[model samples]
Target: MLCQDSAFRLYLDRCRRHKFGLTEAQLPDGTHNEQDARDWICAACSIESRAELDHNLEAWQTFRAIRNRFNRWRARGGA
Candidate 1:
């Protein structure tokens, strides 16, 4: 999973390089989310998804993998 994070971070880094950077966007629900940011991150880079910008599956998978790794590492150290 760490390998995946490294890969994704590298991807997102490329995204960051492509986009000026991820920026917050207001959703239809009227809450600010990373939708626009992720959209820019992908549309300007790799792995486009048809999911709602905020709920984009590609982003979710990347986030989930990173979070899971963090949680597992935290558990090991009683953090």
Candidate 2:
């Protein structure tokens, strides 16, 4: 179970309406921030069928881990 926040729900709807993917750039709605995007994608991912959710979860986790690691590195000293 994940946090069912308003932002998450909004993104879920966005995903349902459009083709949601791992967007590298800032989403037009300003979902570029890591946590914000995660909230959006996670919600989006969870809204699909169980099979789809299961498949997408791994990819989402990988993406999030990589992004978080990068974020940490930047916080430390990385460019």
Which candidate gets the maximum TM-score versus the true structure? 1
lDDT of each: 0.45, 0.47
lDDT of candidate 1 over 1-79, digit per residue (tens): 3323343344444434446654433111222135544554455424565344366666667656655655665566523
lDDT of 2 at 18: 54
Which whole-number lDDT from 0 to 100 does residue 16 have in model 1? 46
Residue range 4-73, candidate 2, lDDT tens digits? 3444334434443456553434344433354555554545445433345455767567546645654564
Worst 10 residues of 2 by lDDT: 1-10
Off by over 4 Å in 2: 1-55
Candidate 1: minimum summed lDDT over ten consecutive residues — where? Answer: 24-33
Q: Which candidate should be chosen as best, given lDDT against the real structure?
A: 2
Clashes in model 1: which pairs? none
